[model samples]
Target: MECVWTRNGSRCGEAASRRCDRCRAVGYCSLSHQVSHRSIHKIECDRFRRQMNRADVLSDFPFTFYVEPSKVQVVSFEKRCSFLARHGVHGLGMWICECSCGSSLINFDTISFIPDWLLSSELCPCNEPSISLQGRLSSWKDYCEWRHLPLSSPAAVILHWPLTVYWAIQLATGCNLLPEIKNELRIHYLGPEKELLQLAAFGELQALFPGVRIYIDFVGPAIPDRRSDERIDLHSYALCNDTACRCKTEMVSKSQAVRMQLHAGFYHDRYGEFSK
Candidate 1:
């Protein structure tokens, strides 16, 4: 980790030996910088602390990932990064935007103007429709009943990518798209990456927009040449722990709710084709 405090448009960048006493998520090279950055850091520090202390942060799941003994319980993105670093894998796409070189700005190190959509834990199926969420969400218990997933499932950690896009759509359309565009929904999901591998995560979108024919265009360089411009159809809801709910008869006859197409190029390079 490196010092988060910036000096003269440049980061201190020195090895951060001192961490914020309250949140412990941010660090500084020295006591002086820590004190100097306190006023600015206080707002986010409080938020980080509150999120870290939430009851759901320490949630355990039935998955083998959680069943195995871990040195530390994976909670916040900061500790999650540290845990992954121990195994020689950098935690990309968590607490920071994915990049080829390295992370900056919205990265966990600085925490400046970090997107609340990525951090908010209250984006669940709750009582307050106006303040929390609309009927777009199914209860965690209900979701688990269908999915056989635990209520406190850590799947959110991985599912945040597509969820963020859904959140952005809500913000962009003033959350009125449900009534405005009812049957067919086309989402141009730009800059796709690891999402290309785990298409099942998009299944959650069905819950978000029930009975809607959702077409997703995953346009990015991550798509291999062999797979580009190929349309893959998802015939049924994502598979769950329950095999009794499905049978060979149903699997072969099901129609797709979510349809995906891969385009292996940067959006800018393929703008001519997409513009049409």
Candidate 2:
């Protein structure tokens, strides 16, 4: 594990050999660095502990991909990486950013803190709405409760997308779609490369903005030429094999929530077309 501490604009890339005794999740390259990062790390230390003690959901998967029960339950940070490595998903896309900002300067090795694999992801959940919360969302605990998923559920990895949209819309235009506001929420989702593969994930928007219809204009040059402009009425959620999954329940059945319109072109070149 890499150093868990970063001071100012600097980072300690030294191998983290010392872990926090209390949580046994976070690590440090040295004692001084650990002391330096305590104030910020203190906030999420307990969260790290809670994340470790949760039930192992991997073994419960109904599909044929059955790993050993012992392999599925990972409480150690080193073992967590090893487990992901076996599946070829050990944070391969971690620290990746597509923003126009100075994301290029971000160095993965020297990154300040390494988030627990299942917690806030590259989707950046920490960047919440600047306006009043309106009881829409307060914390991850409440969100997992509302979604009927456990804290250990690997939902945040992808759920970050819908949550990001919820935060972005509010931060930009202060559009808080409270339960009473039964309005159609339209989003111009630009630059959709990987997201196109899992379009169903955006369906979580229905839950994020309950009672409000969401129309997603997925405009990007990555769209296939054959489907340059197409409208898809997302009538249902993706099928799930697990009976315990909410997607398998009536909460998601027959739900016509998200409508998608694909436009295949660069947003800059198609600005005039989109403006119309």
Clashes of 2: 0
lDDT (Cα, tens digit) per residue for candidate 1, span 73-135: 244333555544443334333323322333433322222111111211232221111232244
| Candidate 2 lDDT (Cα, 0 to 1) | 0.52
State candidate 2's TM-score: 0.48
Q: List the residue pairs that clash in candidate 1.
A: none
Q: Distance from true position, residue 245, model 1, in Å?
A: 4.4
- The C-alpha lDDT values of all candidates are 0.51, 0.52
Best lDDT among the predictions, by candidate number = 2
- The list of candidate 1 runs beyond 4 A from truth reads 1-73, 77-151, 175-179, 245-256
lDDT of 1 at 262: 77
What number of clashing residue pairs does each candidate have, in the order they appear? 0, 0
Highest TM-score model number: 2
TM-score per model over all chains: 0.47, 0.48
State the lDDT at 59 in candidate 2.
Answer: 33
